[model samples]
Target chain A: MRRIESCFQRLADQKRKALIPFVTAGDPVKEVTVPLMHAMVDAGADIIELGVPFSDPMADGPVIQLACERALAHNTSTRDILDMVKTFRETNADTPVVLMGYLNPVEVMGYEAFAKAAAQAGVDGVLLVDLPPEEALDVKPLMDAQGLDMIFLVAPTTSDARIKLIGQAGSGYLYYVSLKGVTGSATLNVDEVASRVETIRNLAQLPIGVGFGIKDAESAQAVSRVADGVVVGSALVNQIAENKDTPNAINDAVGGILSAMRNAMDQ
Target chain B: MSERPDFSAFPDARGHFGQFGGSFVSETLMGALDELTAMYARLKDDPQFRADFDYDLAHYVGRPSPLYLAERWSKQLGGAKIWLKREDLNHTGAHKVNNTIGQALLAKHMGKPRVIAETGAGQHGVATATVAARLGLTCQVYMGAEDVERQKLNVYRMKLLGAEVIPVTSGSRTLKDAMNEAMRDWVTNVDDTFYIIGTVAGPHPYPQLVRDFQCIIGREAREQSLKQAGQLPDALVACVGGGSNAIGLFHPFLNDEGVAMYGVEAAGDGIETGRHAAPLSAGRPGVLHGNRTYLMEDDNGQIIETHSVSAGLDYPGVGPEHSWLKDIGRVNYVAADDQEALSAFRELTQVEGIMPALESAHALAYARKLAPTMSPDQNIVVNLSGRGDKDILTVAAIDGIEF
Candidate 1:
């Protein structure tokens, strides 16, 4: 099984929802990322979705956009990100690592090469925010061949027909964007999300991970009730942004939020 | 490689223009774009929509703008006769209004009460604001903070026309950033908001619909060329930022085997300087702003900041159709540096008593170079996409003149 699948399977067996924390690959600094990933796992993250910083992250709000800018300011290349993933694999191989960002960076590094490099670097899944299943026809097979799951987003407005198509095309899980807006823009109403998640569940067989508007332990716990996983991005990135000046405080600050959310989710 | 594609059959139902121009937006936007595509497909041929669009174009936009022969300017160039397609004469003073008018009508039909747009120089903002005011729709325009500062008059114009001009301060703080912010807004408010994409870029139906709406320019230019010049012009020239005007003037002529086309991109210092926006001439294909197109990006595929004297032409990517046309060897993609465009701006102002927008000046610059090489009997139609009134401040600043 793919690392992402096995990670979910392990979580399911324990009757626990997955805690996925997303961080831009080289935010604040390059050296902070690998240790941060390890810290996130130690803090009770099931899967780490490391964002490959892009110049234009349209779907993201100000918090994560700034995170991308911080990462890109250091000239973090795709190779550097893959290297970070490889280094993380040295100490821990069990936690599934999913690279999340826009599509152009992977497009620059040819899809075949990106798939091979990502898989070899112990990365298990990719969630390109811009590349929907319609446009992923050519790239999906290449990723699947490399034992990499091509994860897709199911938005609040996504139709049942598209959910079926995405569920069949996707592997690992379907990330349900719990709001209509960009990440970190709005507050989530759990009931609305619950209804949407229920519809998605009826249409698609894959595990559903809910993100966007998940800001705190309460929100994460609320999402974990209906979701197989809770994907927290802007909130953790906001922690990194606030603690960026004190580099030493970043892992603890980010991990602290995830730990609290994990503890809350367990209850 | 085997055989050329039928130009008419392009952007197949999936919106791919020969591996370019696919709807590469997020899942949140896919359904919205699909809805838009389906709506455009239905209304593009509907006679009532067409009649309404035509009624507005004729009375409000001043349609069939004259294709004036620049006799004195052509005499000075000493080669091909130059015919100016007077898009600059349109209401709101640019070709951008053509697309805005069409989109506003669509907004009314779709029952969308709010309209939004991203503007580089604020021409599109002002145009959107103008239409929104006329239609009694709430309009919000996202413009880069730098642009809002630079284009103070246009910001004022939009506000006066009842638009909420929001300054986007993200990502290079320019046109691309404004577009990013606008996309975020659209995804958030997809139900009631109609996004009036200002150019021939963006996902699927936008490129198709914007092109369809603006095709009137080429259609009129074609008819005018025959009526005034006694035959179709030997060549067509238009500036390409996001390539709305160029595509507008070129789409109708795509099958004219006898006519050649040139799409001039803005070269800030020059393409070799790596600071320009001439993606077709220098950059490679990549995805940005929901479409696959040639983009000015670093080796890591991060979009690089572009520079151009013309704010409207400073975008890092060209329209995807232009990319397809470039690959198919249909439209000849060229570049004009800031210096050449400035000189052309001065020459047109002095010679023809016409002040072309700096964006249009890029096309004029190329025409100046090409006109001198051709025989006087042959003619060239240049799309004067907008007037230089908005750019007077930019010109004054360049000339070290203080207001």
Candidate 2:
């Protein structure tokens, strides 16, 4: 079985929700990413979404945007990011790593080549913010051929028709944006999210991972009740931003939040 | 590139102009795009909406702008007779108001009480502000921090017109970044606000609607050309930033088999220097700012910073329809360096007493080169897209004058 499918299945058997931690690769520096990924998994992270730094990140709020700038400062390339995943796969084999960012970088590398290289590097899935299922006609087949899952986002405003389309095209879990704004913007109403999750469950059979505006342990716990997986991005990236000058503090600061959320979800 | 069989039927149902244009935005904005598309489809052919739009254009915008013949400049060039499309004479001193008015009417029809826009040269901001003030809608405009500093007069104009100008400080801090901020705003306030995209770009329905609204420029020019010159001009020239003015003029004359079209891009220093904004001349195909088009990006698919003397022409991508037009050999994409455009700006001021905006001067620069190669009996129509009054400070700074 593919790594993403197996990872989710194991979490289902344990009767616990999945905890997903996201961080931009090569932020602060390149050497710290692989270590951080391993440390997050140790802190109860089931899946890791590693952001490939792009010059333009429109959907991200201030936190992830700054993280991308810091990563790109060292001139991190897509090849370097793939190498990071390959190194992480050396010691860790259970946790799935998903590459997330805009589509231009992958377009620069060509769809077929990126799919092959990512699969070889032990990457499990890809979620490009700008590429909807309508524009995924060419790349989806290439990714499916490599046994790599194509994850897609489902927003609160997504129509029933598009949900059906995305459900058919996607392979991994669906990312449901908890709010109407960009990542790291204001609060998410749990009741509203619950209603949307219920609607999405009726239409698509895949596991739903809710993201955007998930700041702390309490919010993550609240989301854990309604969602199969809780995806936290900007909150962890903010920790990296606050401790960027002292790189040693980044891992502990980021891991602390994931650990706290993990404990709360387990309770 | 091979020629497409038909130019009229484009941007089919899915908004793809032969795979160049599509809705490549985040899922959050998809519903908003769908709503806007549905509304526009209903109103585009309605007689009442057409009559309302025409009434505003005639009295409010001072339309049917003259097609003045630049007799002395053409005679001095020893080439084709040059006719200028006086879009500079429109309200707000540019062709930008034509689109803002059209979109402002759409906002009125939809009962949206707030409007937002993004600006590069500040022309679009001023135009949007002017319409928003007239319509009594709360308006906000996003501009790059760098542009706010350079275009202070227009910034003050926006404020005077009761529009809030928000300075965006992210990314390369220019037009593309401003657009990113606008999209963020729309995604958050999709229920109450309408995003009036300034050019023929962005996601679907915007390119189509903005093109349909601004097509008045070409439609008017075609009729005026037939009356004044007794035939369509031999060729057409317009500067391409996001390519609103160029496409507006070209789309109406698209089916005219004998009329050639030229879309001039800004070559900041030169195309060879890798520092210019001429994507069609130098860059490759990639997606940016919600659509697939030619882009100025690095090897890793990251967008690179583009340079241009004219702030309005300093974008890294052209309109998607321009990409399709170029691919199908309908429009000749050309470039003009800063020095060449500057000289054209100065010469038109002295010879014709009409100082063209620096962005429009790029088109004039290319026209100057192309006209001399053709006979005097031939004609070239240059879109003087905006007046240079706002650029006086920029010209003075270059000439070492304080005021």
Pick the lDDT winner.
1
Q: Could you tally the backbone clashes for each prediction?
A: 0, 0
User: After TM-score superposition, what is the CA distance of residue B275 in candidate 1 from its true location, in Å?
Assistant: 1.7
How well is each residue in B53-93 modelled by candidate 2, as lDDT tens digits? 99989999999889999999999999999999999999899
The positional error of residue B14 in candidate 2, measured at the CA in angstroms, is 1.0
TM-score of each: 0.99, 0.99
State the lDDT of candidate 2 residue by residue for A1-267, as single tens digits.
Answer: 998888888889998899999999999899989999999998999999999998988898888889999999998889999999999999998899999999998899999999999999999999999999988999999999999999999998999998988888898899999999998999899999999999999999899899998999999999999999999999999899998899988889999999999999999
Query: Which whole-number lDDT from 0 to 100 does residue A180 have in model 2?
Result: 92
In angstroms, the error of model 2 at A68 is: 0.8
List DockQ, one per candidate, in order: 0.94, 0.85
lDDT of each: 0.94, 0.93
